[model samples]
Target: MHRIRLLTLILCAALAATLLTSVTARADAHPRETGRTVSGPGTPRAEVGLDPATGTPTLAVTRQGRTVLEPSPLGIVTERADLSTGLTLTGRTDREINEHYTTAAGKDRTRSVRMHEARFRFRSTATGARLDLTVRVSRDGVAYRYTLPATSGNVLGETSAFTLPGDAAAWLGAYRKDNENLFNGYGATAAPTGEYMMQGLFRTGSGDGADYALIAESDLSGSYAAAHLTHTAGSPTYGIKLWDGTPIQTSGTGTLTTPWRAVITGDLATVTQSTFTDDLAPASRVRDTSWIKPGKALWTWLAGGRAAGQSLEMQKGYVDYAAARHWPYTVVDAGWYFDPAQWDVTDPDWQQNSWIPELVRYGRERGVGIHVWIHHRDLDTPEEREQWLPTLEKWGVKGVKIDFMDSESQATFQWYDQILAATAAHHLLVNFHGSTIPKGLQRTWPQVMSFEGVNGEEKKTNTPQHLATLPFTRNVLGSMDFTPGAFHKPDRPNAGSDAGELGLTVLYESGIQNLSGKPGSYDARPVARTFLEQLPNAWDETRLLAGAPGESAVEARRSGSRWFIGGTYAGAARTAAVPLTIGHGTWLVETVTDTPAGLVRTPHVVRGGATLSVDVVANGGFAAVACRWYAGRTDC
Candidate 1:
């Protein structure tokens, strides 16, 4: 045993050394370019020059070799490289992007420019990786991105491409794939609207191969936004459509700076590991704020008892319940202001409703915050949106949950940026629902508290399978507002049990967590109430314990001296033993919250002096506690 322990220590040290060397080598390879004309107005044009030996292409801007954008072959397989065999690469120069001018509409004038861009197409074979890279100059700005076609035969996956930007916390956006109503559920079509971002794509299959794409876009300051429109997705879809019938599966964001870093691997563990080791650096500002106060846990009242009408009595009851249990906030979903039929931002009676002021005062007195819901369509017109901001602020609303931002056009993309900024200016928190996945936006605008771009609790009733499938695919991007903690059973018997709802509080990660059932539900479950009291919605440090896409996941989070861990399973029953390790201090066992059974009190024990392990079950998970031990431990 002693020899084995020594050997394990040596192996860990060696692995750490290798990782450091690789990171150092990468940093040394690419020194930041001193002075280059990266941004300016000119006739938009793009050209690609290939390096024959490496088979890598170099992107040139403005007919000069000023900035060399190099992309490596991502999904290369052992198959022969042919027109349609392996991943095929091609480039096109389109004049549509260069024609930019202004158009007049009556007395007002609007900018109308033909977007100039280049296209790179990647076609995958039965056994290899394929990718397409495109650079375009659009009216909004310039963009250099990539796309992976949905193939019929084998799958193609790609990774390890890098981008250089002026700053680490640059603006990034993604739209959810809008073709769900068309494809239903065959091959990556028609996923839940509120899940995964539209831009990032990840593919997996049983036929020994997978197809995927990694796209990166930068605004070049104020120059132009780039474009990379791949295959026409058959008809006019509501959101950004990338393929004919295929839908996007998974997506996320990471840092791209002087070292030029980003990597996408197959499984969840590999992806997290690569992101931490290769992509993540010492962020100038660590955004976790558990130190100031324990992050507040919220109870979302969207699909609960208030689904029908916006009743002040109903909202007051929910707030009273959350306040009784000490939960922080309660969210009043959409349909509260105008009639769902004639929903409009410019409506005079929008903020004139009686329930608005009633619920606000009721919540404030009881130490609870009220969050109002708004849709993206209502905020599309900038002038109109500005009018509503003051009203929301005057109402003393703590936050606003904006929904339905499902477009990837430059105009819609810019709209998202403006809304976040405006919300921040009002000193109000924002939660983007029915929107795209987050791309480090939380780091830039901390007030943009949470986002719902994952297939969350709403679909659990219709599609039971998605409840288990989403954590592995969509949850990795960032903090996912899954609207967890539902306390009701399915309407039908033998469909499944509703007992698994408690597991989600631990399973999902969000700065603003929503307990998704009526307040009465919490009154019935003593175990859940206890767990909610102890759980920390935000964290100081977060670690991926164990996981694989569409399988199972285990995560550990720390806020100050206390540590909490959560594990979950998608389809099948699974088990994972997680070690309790956070920093180098000694820890003591506190409590373990399990399923319907209840919490178990254990004797205090010391760890970090030794490795600790926890075991979990499938479709089910566990949340355990470990805190710093100051002196000799005793029985709890």
Candidate 2:
């Protein structure tokens, strides 16, 4: 009986092996690659080595020499290593470590190996320790990795830190306003020590820079170190930071650990990528309201500037334009409320304001919703917040834009969470300006529509160089309120007039897209107008077409049957051929939007397995359409 059972098991194992082989072959036949490859479960393979002597892991990248990312045993140690690609360090001291690599394939294909070291560490007399990670990037030598020393309390202490070289600063200067320090005049200045600390920096040209900062903090006691590319000037833009998932104890009250991971790729095309995790202790805290649907998009004023009663006619015209175009919402910008100094949410002035009632009425009449702007500092007190809620609800406001968060204390962070929750209680959507980088709160609070944490069009005067850097840098954190859609040229006052502005509709991801150009601008360029009208702020699917760091990028997005493709160049002009392969259904018709020549409507016949090749000019791009099968149509 035992021999018979063994034979049966062997036969079954052979059958299973054959089935697995067949499935693997089928999957291999239809392999698909999307976006740029990174170190993940599916990453390619490469040879990695760890020095038993020094306990540092070294990666022998093909093009780049043996690159040592972190120290051996990869714990908390600061020493020099080969700084080839850059440095890699673990967030905490006691966390687990992992490594990944992509195998070399064809020519021109770049492969990389990544080592992730994580652990927990404790400081003297400090019941808990915050995670700190430092990764140094260099061109020649091996990258160095070290754990940043955590301070005992809130006060920041000066410690030896690395600063970007002068040449690097000069290289980054071209992207700044007036070639000054990027963070100069923004409330916080770069320390001579050159260590990047959590402090304010002017985002070059956004007028008010007092509210922005670069923050470094740890989420877990010794689990994750987070560097926030933050802003407080009415709106903020987040840079990149690395995060290793771990858990730690909270020091005091009103504190919850949330880990944010970001990467700022100076390379223009693949600029930034980020991930966020909520490190909340299971059932140990106050009411948590982090589960919210996230929506992002741009906005524009339909009425005149925010002064009292400038011209309702202008407001009406703007509202008319939005309605005619079927836009999602129109914003009542800063000037709508009474004087900032005298304004009080409970004051009769709030109740008597004609802007909200009139605009809401007009917007509702036209099927467009209204989002009103408010000053963040004023809402600091609970009384102010309480008064504003009922008023906004009574006014039928769909959303509120909160600006000027301006601080990085634990208190302020808590307040931000409060505002998000408070507004959600009223069913009012929220857009945060002068804020910190998104820590994936949108996933927790769906009503928290969008946030302006980027150096957007407001900095057009600085340089067009920032445009190329943003996609891979600032965009990774979360939805950005870049406020795109200004059709006017640079000559227009305060407009960052890049031809690529049109492409931003496709490049930047937002649920609430604020169309900023004047009505006349869109009217003059009907092709651009049609493009805007056709765009859906929400998308069902998004695809990164083709790109290299700091070069150019092509992207395709799908909303139902309609498809939109946008391509942008960093500095130089380039061309690309993008193939449309979004779905299986055939398109019945096609429409192309091209500038100067206006919208060109064309019809193409496509089948299930056919691909449409498109060519785009330099500093220019193409938007094509493919309608799904409806009724009797066969071509798209």
Candidate 3:
């Protein structure tokens, strides 16, 4: 029986995520199952106990008595919520969830894992409705969500909470204005009212060393709004708070299922690499995904200056440069439409419409695709947007960058979905700027290539610390458009080094790596040119070599047979090691390292697993590229 079960699990793991939507949407109130305790039967065990006294449920996780996650508060409640006084467990079920799926976007990959799931149904003695809390456990960590049947009051919001140890500090930054802030150290209890955005990392120390777990939401497709973390008073640790705008989201709605709130537990490395986001999300909804290609796009905004500004000639120069460098796409930013000097006035109709096609034709001749930039509210009506957007296909445009949509309301949330759907229909990829944190939307709609949710290089106030925090925070949510490549930014305030900027290119992930830097930045060095021009937009495997959340880090990412390694630092000089494991072919290695004098490049080769040492100065960088068969190959 055991062998047969193992074989069945292996076969199940080979397919994409296919399962019945368990705990189906319903309206009836579940009966109370007070004083019941259930243990998750798995390697990393999770035990949940319902307290009849307080009418609330608490969760505790352990690996052979080693506490992975301390007892934490677990439930969902809205503004009109309070069944805690009469909360009672009604039904309990223990089952196994075995599923697999292929990644549709972002770092392309596959997931095949098994886990145990426990569902606890409860009745609100006061509200007279049933609510269910469903939890999943595996080797990585635990994830759970609250399901409110229609019988309950209009479920508008959730205070879904997670309480951690007081001694432990969170790898959190400010939720800031638009979640574009850098993360740093803050005690789980010390975090002010609210500062952390999606995927908060909490690190704790026990007898041996430290443990890490990431907190965030996944599969936030339907009526759910984005979830943020806050400093709350009542807990063994910290709390998870979901932010809502005017006219509360999911309010008085039909059967409401909140996004999957997760606790990814392990070391900082395991916690960072866990596939909790894509793993919990559903498979691709679009059947035809051949047109969605993630690649590098040359952007004009970075080169837009008064001299030789956004004129047609300047755009042509950028196109020729992009084509010469082998970049796949070129972006005509906002300046192409409205005069930058006077935002209210528009360029001539011919310049806006006809010039675009002319530029597209110029680019098409040289094998470069064009992407147009548009504002969110410009083409508000269906007639305007539907008319203006599809016309791009005729001009050989590959995508559109929709900007300034700083909204999180239910209306705006749904509108985002609509824009993706519409663009996909037009066979154009999409990017959202001034946007919110991602929730696995790219995987669902691969055409929705990327978004700008980070405090990227455009801000003069951004520093190396800010970039350090991104990997664990904003980037963990999904592909972020923190346009990098400001190689000459040291002249400005709070600027990181040029070498650091190069490292950032390999660190940040996006379907369209629409970077912001001088057009001639990488032209001086053949090594720089080779690295930038040949960089793959997506990767098959990635390794987070060494990192301390918001401090210093190193990463090695692989696309096909090539490997790209980058290291970054903050405040002080540090040494990072790239653990290289090579086989199957001989390789050529090119490196760019930072020094007090300036940046330098060197070439070498290696046969097997050896740690490549990198010395990074304060706010500096280290980048290297290794590929088999690229030594004498022109295609490289």
Candidate 4:
């Protein structure tokens, strides 16, 4: 028996040595140190390199034989359990990505995109576990993500640096814990250090035909925290840091693909025109999306709920106004259940909120939908969801605008998905306010009407600069219930001229256009009312005729046969050569331009192929449109 045991132990020891040797030899056989280039196949091409020699990988795009990525050392860094130091390349794959998608509701309904992609497989030198870095380059810009080979451990964090050359100008929107917070437009070097909101825009400079780009993440299935830009004061470094949060995740599957770290590239036109998010994100998860509706909604929050925005009579005033304007929805913003004067749902009087059902019934009687606002934390449990959602649906509530999520963890994502599922199951449309950036999730759940992730009129501080920055940033991902159509003059000083506000109505996109400002205030304003009459729920096409982010902006949008063009400028007044695309023929034209007296409309005539020259003043805007039909022709 002793002899047999000794032989078995010796045999086991030999087997262990052979396994270790095999792993070491396999890792060594592959090139441990590699230098390879992943170049773009599309216009304004971006080429990046992946090297295993330096575990600190740099993201450099070869442009004009010069590395577009300013500093050569900016690259990817990561953390995990076995591979605490991230990955080192041990293998490679080069390929092309050609994808097309269509959304029932979005900035544009359909998107098609292609990218040159390269996958560099790496094995941790410390642990034989493997990972892959995929770099996808297209006209929109560059994107990369780490592909983890199934793990049962938590990812501590990532410190990937993304820097720009010559210290490019940038608009850093620090993490938006709420709306009304503005982005800081600083010289690249002076950019505020730390985290940034999703879809942040950065430009080269105030030069002739200078280029700009935006950074954001796509396909967040929630295995990791959202990524944000991080830098230090007076530093030339730019990189990404995971939005640190609690509930360190500890679960996964066969393979975990992190969200795409994407950078949108090109001129303001190109950036605005880019559909990177919609095109590449996972296809819609909702199979039957025919019930999804995108339209304007009236809310009492900005109207200052309860203070002046309270009372059943006042609430019906909103419903009456919505019905009058043919708006689809009228929202009883937070405080309807209780008092806006204070925040607490536990009050016994809260249940006495008979006004909500009555209001919903009134809205229904007037052919309007009723959408209410609520907090995310309030409905965290399945029982709570089971109770509240069904009750709201029974109360004739058409939709909900859930708020104050303030989280980007995996658990939050699961809950979000659950909410969407339950809401859709209830046949209710949803508007996500105080939420994270749209990951093209609306494509998955078309019932998610709009996302209020921008610094809209909610907390004020809005300006022409901020509004212009949006078309290229936040709006790029999806609709922004920028709720922008604020035609009231008093609000214009902080936001823009009445006409600029009108322009915003066209510039911004949303599944629900939640217009701010009291309707009574603008009741005497004919021009403002006329602009509202023409507001469109969905756009057939979008054209960036002229302008850049902060300097100015001009856009031409189409809804069916009618066409609308809007222009706004910042700093010094500027001229924009706006193009027309409403087919060929003479047509009646109307112009709403910012005048000292106020927004005024002038009638004129214009034809297809003619450029509508608009001279806009600082913080001023102009909107003009030509009816699709001619005097004698009926076909528009």
Candidate 5:
């Protein structure tokens, strides 16, 4: 029996050793077979690895043992060479980036970030052109950009593509020059064939129920035109589509670089919390951002009720409304500078509509600033900008809302840079209307208050589902000028509960929070009035407590010691579980939600870490504020 047992043990040891050798051999050969890889630092590790199966450089990303981004093609196509295929890796370098940064406008004010970056240098076997592909992997996402020799000839476009899983669910917006389209969900295979905007968020359903990938671009410069995604029916791959024009001429010295193509991944919380796009953006160029202040503004374009036109009397009345609500600015929208009949800036009688100076003076005395509007056609040329910008400054105009710049060509981006610089020089805030989606330009020019790249309250398309989707998609990129607060009946044509409209002030983050409701409308509801009065335009901290794109969204934000929570739901009536994890303390919780009678405010007391059951009606919303409660009075 002893002899037999010893023989069995020896046989088992040898078999185990053989299996270990086989596994070791496979692990050792992985780099040579699959190419190079760099992994992010944290739980649910994220890795970007090169695939060289087709003798061309391709990239794939995986997190927590699931594919976030499948093997997709990568290269820059220029007139001199088709560098998309037949590439050989020549050299590679890896590094770690760990830093902390702050932003003037975003979901949160500060961020501490760490990422793993790798530069894989490849030589095109076809033309011998060297292409440097830089891949950076953060804890929650991945970003990459391409760099090529300037002499590579005129750049036609790129071959970079994203191939998602066919089973994955995607929320996409069709391409629009102004980026004012609504998002709709579709299967990756069933996605419509056409150009899509910068943002497209996908759900991988990777068991943890939080796996998502958001496609976006960052650090856009004037030298390169912005890119949109082009999809073909029945295919899961989306390729890069440039503006409708000829190839960009090869100029300048050294190397030409493309903007960072970023994919924010992970669960909903990680996707919302990841500031990777802004992290990839260039650092701020403004020396003194103190003059750039963020606050609420009264806009008279959409929700002015009877007083819609931009006459001097109407402007002063809106300014009075802004002052009464403690809102700092009132935007006198279009028709302010041009003649009502001609709508021309060069009209000899344009100077006749010159109550702007008097209105500015009137607003200044009452502690309200005025922002005038101008048509982009009238302000595109350098000569026109120089002529009108200084005159508006001389009139003490606080800002300019320039509209109808509905293109993202290279020249248009150059114009944007020029206008931002000119406005900065004059210390004038800028709100771009009918513009492309923001790509972290606010960091470079702090004076840029907002961008109307969304189908906001100005349109009846601001449905509940659309509003619920913005936070996870477009608003995640940067400040969105959603122009919330359409509480009145006739203006609120879309299907949403009154509480949802009130909650938008907290749900959307804009440097200039444009309040669109009339004075009488807000006066009737003291609860909403008081809520708006205390809400801050900027936040010290933000969290996506519980949310899913399109279906529902619930967020909690902090401004100093007080915590504000907003929830928006679509589809059907349900109770949302809001976990009050503000801190360990007794607190006073005041909630504004829709009841059968109307919008009402309710207050209660609860300890930290307790869950608050918020009943959100179908296609409705809710807003709440929590503060430390002590003695007989609330700390808030």
Candidate 6:
């Protein structure tokens, strides 16, 4: 009887200890499992949990019961620990954020942002290293990032990936430093094994053409390099692949905050009109942005005027053209300071040059600003910028087009911030060329007018499908320096119609619309000039009325009381019925359409909410101007 009692006591003690260990483990892994699901302001939902089979952290998003993103993997890969697996969710927190602000450029003037945020803190069970995964879900999309504890370590890469539905359609572009790769359509599972650059758009549902998700990143500071997406053969997952560079290191003091790996979701209109990319970025760092003006400019490079390198006569002609058209600026492109006689001596003391200051003075007199191009290598460091930027500002140069950066590494990203800060100090606007896609930096620095990261007119291989894909993919992120409107130029053979070329002026949103046509080209096309004269670089409101990724695109933008509609179609000919949702009023409509004879302009009147039907030919386009009809006169 003593032996039996002793055995029973030992067994009971063992059972009690096992139960306590199990309870403690569960509590450490999921302290607040009940708050795993987060719902946005609308139908968007983000569910965070561990994969039962793999024991890895997972994130899934949905809209109106439709899966916008499949259960995607989420974790960080550090040098000292494998945080992707063997992780324990030590804690969790939730909150809501609401903000309203005005923007200097891009899709909307006034932005209202509301987001539901959740932070999941985890500890590596093996190494005991801590990481916090923060997620924010807005009405239009979902974004998340990893935050590491202040420890001296190197972040190798991310294990986070975007898993697409098997049947989803994707429009993606190959990774390029200039981001000038061509976008092509493909099945989600068949995405190229190579790599794809940012702002990729995917169609989640085939029904109603309403569901879409744009994959992008925001707040990409200097701590980490920009990453692209890579797919495995036959897999629906696109994993993160960082650019070749040094691993992100922490100094054991300040916490390392990674960029937000964002996936924007909703209907086509929601995807196109969404400022969620800008919403995810930091607020404007330049407090006094009043001097940062957005307007149209004349670019002489594409017009073969670069051959007249530094010629005062050639520049004055272009400046006079800008002044005549009421345009705000003229860009003096490359070769402005190149000593043609001494081709080897590339870097010269441009301040001592006579023509640049004269051109600046001449442009200022005619209400036109001069923007000069400088190679990124020339103004690379802080010392170089301090020496050159102040002199350029003193010379009355309004903005600088910094070109040939050609990098997306950590160092390059840091360089971009430094340059923007330096230019803001000098009160000069900026346009970035040979650069990565806009990671919502324009919102932080309003002086950053646009980025030449698209296969714009500079590339002759651009097609109608490429043009149609832009409003959905690239332009949605921010201003695109497309350098459009080069109609009737023999050397510049556009694949789309002349009317389509005209439509680009309104469709692509660039803070500075560098018109590519020379003076004679615009003079030759009167109808195109008429449309350009009224086009505004910045808009009060913008809407994607009707379209699809590659098949077609129609957009409407408003500036004050006037509204402009632009449409482009690929593949077969179709009559686009665009809903003019410019509020209640009689609108005086003037449209530039492609006809059997040539480009034609017609005038009529229509009530608001009426459908403006346009017959777009295969690879053709059209543009229209609508103003409130007040007592037989238009309020334009």
Over 396-449, each residue of candidate 6 has an lDDT whose tens digit, in order, gives 999999999998988888898799889999999999999887888988889999
**lDDT value for model 1:** 0.47
C-alpha lDDT (0 to 100) for residue 557 of candidate 1: 63
Top candidate on TM-score is 6
lDDT of each: 0.47, 0.45, 0.69, 0.70, 0.81, 0.84
Best prediction by lDDT: 6
Q: What is the per-residue lDDT of model 4 for residues 1-636, given as tens digits with 9 covering 90 to 100?
A: 999999999999999999998766544443334335555545444444435455555566544343345533433233444442445666666667777776656657667778877677767676667767787778767777877766625566554566776667887787755433566677777776666776667777456546776877887765656666777877766666666644336456567677787777776777887777665577777777776777777777766555533477888888898888888888777666555544344564543455678888888899888888878876788987986788788887888889888766677777887898899888788888777778757766778888887787654566667766777778878878877665553655334467777777777778788887678755766787767766787877787877677667777777776777777777756565666645688666677876678778876666776876665666777877667646664322
Clashing pairs in 5: 210-267
The CA lDDT at 365 in model 4 is 93
* lDDT comparing candidate 4 with the true structure: 0.70
**Which residue pairs in model 4 clash with each other?**
57-75, 161-239, 162-238, 162-239, 306-309, 306-310
Question: Which parts of model 5 have CA positions greater than 4 angstroms off?
Answer: 1-35, 43-53, 206-209, 305-309, 340-353, 489-496
- Supply candidate 4's per-residue lDDT for 508: 78
Order of all candidates by lDDT, from best down to worst? 6, 5, 4, 3, 1, 2
lDDT of 3 by residue, 352-469 (tens): 4457888888998998888988888875567757766777776778999988877654566677767767888888988888777767677677788788877777766665666677
Q: Poorest 10 consecutive residues of model 6 by lDDT?
A: 341-350
TM-score of 5: 0.90
Residue by residue across 1-636, what tens digits does model 1's lDDT show? 999999999999999999998766533332234111123244323344444444454433331222212222222221122222234343232324332221110000122344444455544433444555544443212344444333422212122232321111111122334312111121232223322233333333322332122232222111111122222122111122222322222221321111111223233343332121111212213243222221354554543544523677777777777787787787787557656544443567756644677788999899888888877776778776777777788888887888786644434555766776677677667777766555445544556566776656665342434444444434544556877766664541112333345556766666678777655566576656776777764665556665544455566666566666565555544334455555577677654434345444444465563544443334555555667776766422
TM-score, one value per model:
0.59, 0.61, 0.85, 0.85, 0.90, 0.92
lDDT of 5 by residue, 1-636 (tens): 999999999999999999998765544333563347767556234344445565566778788778777888788888888778778777766678887877676677888778877777778776788888888888878888988887787789888899987788888889999999998888876898988888998888655654799999988877788888899989989888877745865574768888899889888888887777877777778787787878889888865542455477878888888888788999887666444564455576565458888999999999999887788987899998987898888889998889999999888888988998899988888889899877878777878888989988878665667878989999888888988887775544333577777888888888889888878888887888989988886888888877788888888889999988888888788887888878898889888988878778888788888888887878888888889988685536
Off by over 4 Å in 4: 1-35, 39-48, 51-53, 62-67, 71-88, 94-96, 205-209, 245-248, 307-310, 339-353, 489-496, 572-588, 607-609, 615-617, 629-636
Q: After superposition on all CA atoms, what RMSD does each candidate show versus the true structure? A: 17.3, 12.6, 7.3, 8.2, 9.5, 7.9
| Shift of residue 585 alpha carbon in model 3, Å | 8.9
Residue 176 error, candidate 3, Å: 3.7
Error of 1 at 566 (Å): 0.8
